[model samples]
Target: MARIASEALIERLAEWGVDTVFGLPGDGINGIMEGLRRHRDRVRFVLVHHEEAAAFMAAGYAKATGRIGVCLATSGPGGIHLLNGLYDAKLDHVPVLAITGMQETSVLGTGYQQEVHLDRLFADVAEYNMMITNPAQLPSLVDLAIRTAYARRGVAHLTLPNDLQVAAADADPYEHVAPARPPQTAPVYLQPPGIPRQEDIEWAADVLNKAERPAILVGQGALHARQEVLAVAETLGAPVVKTLPGKAVLPDDSPYTTGGIGLLGTRPSEELMEETDVLFMVGTNFPYSKFLPEPGKARVVQFEADPVRAGARIATDVPVVCDAKEGLAALLPLLTPRDDSAHLAKYQKMMAKWRSDMRSLENPDRDPIAPQYAISVVDDLATDDAILTCDSGTIATWAARHWTIRGAREFYLSGTLASMANGLPYAIAMQHAYPDRQVIAYVGDGGFAMLMAEFLTAVQHRLPIKVIVNNNNSLGQILWEQMVLGYPEHGVRFAAPEADFSAWARSCGGFGAKVSKAVDVAPAVREALQHDGPALVDVDVNPNEPPMPGKVSYDQAKSFAQAFLKGQPHRAAIASTLFKDRIQRLGD
Candidate 1:
């Protein structure tokens, strides 16, 4: 009846407010699974079909909730499978704790079964990585790992050997050490928000006041400071441009706000960046520097929580290192509000026209459903508070351009890492966290097919997630990338006999539907959304459609044309659509 090390670990995590853990069970982790079984009331284990999906789910959970997410896996391959998703968490700077099983301590260096030196493997991905050799080390190690993940806002990893996991909690060589440290059992609270100095705020305000035209660029870091962002934008009469992960920072329908920036951004945003004299970047290290104001052309004022990341992306005239909400709030009062509406009015007009142009592309009657139209339908029908997740690829373009983040709606994707197949897993985690809310996954055929098995996890858990697969039957993003880069399209198309994802969903006891015609897009999406259980809608979007960039350069256009001249395999099908799209945009 003696407590085990695994039980102590679980109990400690529960005290830190972790109610769920995402992972799969394997013999290598049997002791940990047993611990979970014993502590079932305190923490529930979410069984995933793949360790990769488990990691993705953990990262997703952390991204949505702003809390530490935990995932577990068995030794060797199971532990290895968590690398990609853990990297996603690391690069995105989200707190996640990854626990992996390992071989018995005695057989670790002997190359025993499932012994892959997990701590070493996870070294690069984890900010704090360690393997627990002694059972007595469990409590302090757990506390440190959890605290490190919180402090760094990155992944923390721990590998526990099978034998030690079940070791008696009383086994303690370190208990006798001087200044006996006890395990921290209280719930962890975030440290106080860092605040910028009055001098720095005054300097940033001075720079902003002198500029004729100021534009605000926000990333995910600004999500918690929505009101502060709005106040600053309103005071400066500036256009607000959001990064992909920062989509929910402000209402997309706000006249002062331009949807997103970079290749997947809006024309208004591009125009604002091009013309603005001052760039006020808030809580975002937007990576696409080319889309920003020309290096020396605009003075940059950035507010970043981490001093190391301050001014890391663009050249800054003033770097305000502090929490975004606090920094912006402090800076707001010092600024002389701009009364001129010309700068803000220009982008608002452009944004209105840009929206109209987008609507023109979403033709409901177009045969062979346009991906834009399909996603737009889902957008129009989604709940105001719905949490939407998207995968990497052309589907991202569609979602970025079409989906309007308004009301209490939230959006997430693999922004920094830009990994594929994260949409479904993110949606699953969001649904698990908010079972009563509407959760949707907008994924491309290529990304969805990578980890489609996770759908069964949804079915098993009875999570009512609606999945909208843009079935283009090809790697749409890569195909267009090749064409735009002047390379002949090759290796982008999937082999013949495309998958019937809807059928697969049905097989897994979930609602399934397919929409092949434009007219069916809305109805099919509605049916899927209304399903009482998990649902998948496989919409056959036009493969010839192009996910055009915000502003295509002359070289890119010429390169695309060159690809067609070089006998790009679907050039005929794509050329007509491209021509039509160009003609429509030219008029705008």
Candidate 2:
């Protein structure tokens, strides 16, 4: 019988479907490292400078592939470093399993060297936590951890004591457990009792039968129900407007499809929402209440999977609680068709006009480089199948508004929690998971500097990722807000001398370029993309320039004007520029 030590553990991991594990080596996990060396052909180990980056890499792999991401680390500080990435995985609903080496079992409570209660330390981040003191318990615990990670769609932690890992055990005593398969649950039908009443259905049919203008609002929930949603949109002769997160629910080229709506939204959708009298919301819980127009003015109908989410934000005259696909299927059969040619034409005109208005800001003649134009250029240069990861801040807003994606591409952002410094970590993970796909990180100077150390992780793995830094010396969003609202800008600017990020990238053994002029952007990007390994494009943009075609309320405008009038001398010119183009009237 062979000993159920660290060597055998790596064998078990390979058997259980772990192809890659990310971690930094240490003394306590030397045995495990040897085992990894033995199985180099079957399982590859990704060594990162920080355990936190390892955890994040695992998360990115899991999110992209829907498989459990695994990471291993030594006890004490190494184990502790995994906390941040684990917490991020838990919050983002990614499956990850972390294995940590611990002190000998005999010295459990004797304050041994490099000793800490790892199970307790990881309790907050993991859905399941366990410590194995006996070699006999290793196989079962490993299987359970994998199962728990998949079941909960979150992180799981397992601690292995040094002594226990090398103990002899009965050979083949534990049977290899097959991976747990997902259950085949019954499909949810959209209809519920006492809802979509016969009278209501008849009235809705009447409205659809007589309506000349109707529009569809698609949300994230519609992604899984694309075919059904498209069918309903086609049947009703209605155009589609998507929420930001629902960008992929319908193809951008679909005839009925407009674009997204809100502050980061495009023109077509906003115009359709404004002109259409009847609006059907499909599978979206858009948070911005202000974007939902007056309920009395528009005849609103909503279909959703969750009952509580149906009318939480805005009043819905027609509400159906069911899956978006199921609801659309049922509603389409009951609705009557009507001529929407005139209505669609009117909104189409509005869309064209708004698009024209938006294009004015992207003119090459515009000075200081319009942020929107820069994003548009990046979008055009990116591959159709590229994966875009954006940091939270003004850069995220710009990327969300301008980045175009197809069905094969993915766009990831920290939308719910809105955390900064996620772009680099996210890019690292994406590169690790899909080496063939192009991965780009759109980040701001402040946000990129926050977690810049992880750039070493990319170099170590030779992961080819492109980092585009929007180096606007200040926090652009907050400054713009201060200029718009009644608040003086304080502590919103970075005073340090600009470090040559391109030089830093080269020093770190990666390709790098610096671009100050607008004409230099394309060539710099082309050069970065041609590099064989990690690359960076440090772009110095105008800090004084505001995001073009500024959209804000009248009250916000007045407050911003007041604040500017009473502002500091250094910012006087920028403040005056913002107020110079102000229009007093509120209506569009």
Best model per TM-score: 1
Each candidate structure's TM-score, on Cα atoms with residue i matched to residue i, is 0.98, 0.78
lDDT of all predictions, in order shown?
0.89, 0.73
State the lDDT of candidate 2 residue by residue for 521-558, as single tens digits. 87888888878999999887667655532245577668
Runs with alpha carbons beyond 4 Å of true place in candidate 2: 1-16, 28-32, 101-118, 121-124, 165-228, 237-245, 251-258, 261-263, 266-338, 341-347, 481-485, 547-551, 568-588
Q: After superposing candidate 1 on the true structure, give the runs of residues whose Cα lies further than 4 Å from its correct spot.
A: 173-180, 183-185, 583-588
Best by lDDT: 1
Q: Which stretch of 10 consecutive residues in model 2 shows the poorest summed lDDT?
A: 579-588
Q: List the residue pairs that clash in candidate 1.
A: none
Clashes of each: 0, 0
- For residues 1-588, write the lDDT of model 1, one tens digit per residue: 778989989988898889889999988899999899999999999999999999999999999998889999999999999999999999999999999999887886886877799898888999999998778776778889988998888999999999988889757756556433464448565675678988898999999999898899999999999999999889989899999999999988897798889999988888889888999999998887888999899999999988889988888999989889999888888888888899889888898888989988887766677788899999999999999999999988998888988899999999999999999999999898898899999998888889999999999999999999999999888999998889889998888898789999999999999778887788888888888999999999889998888888899999998998888988878877877676655665
Candidate 2 has an lDDT of: 0.73
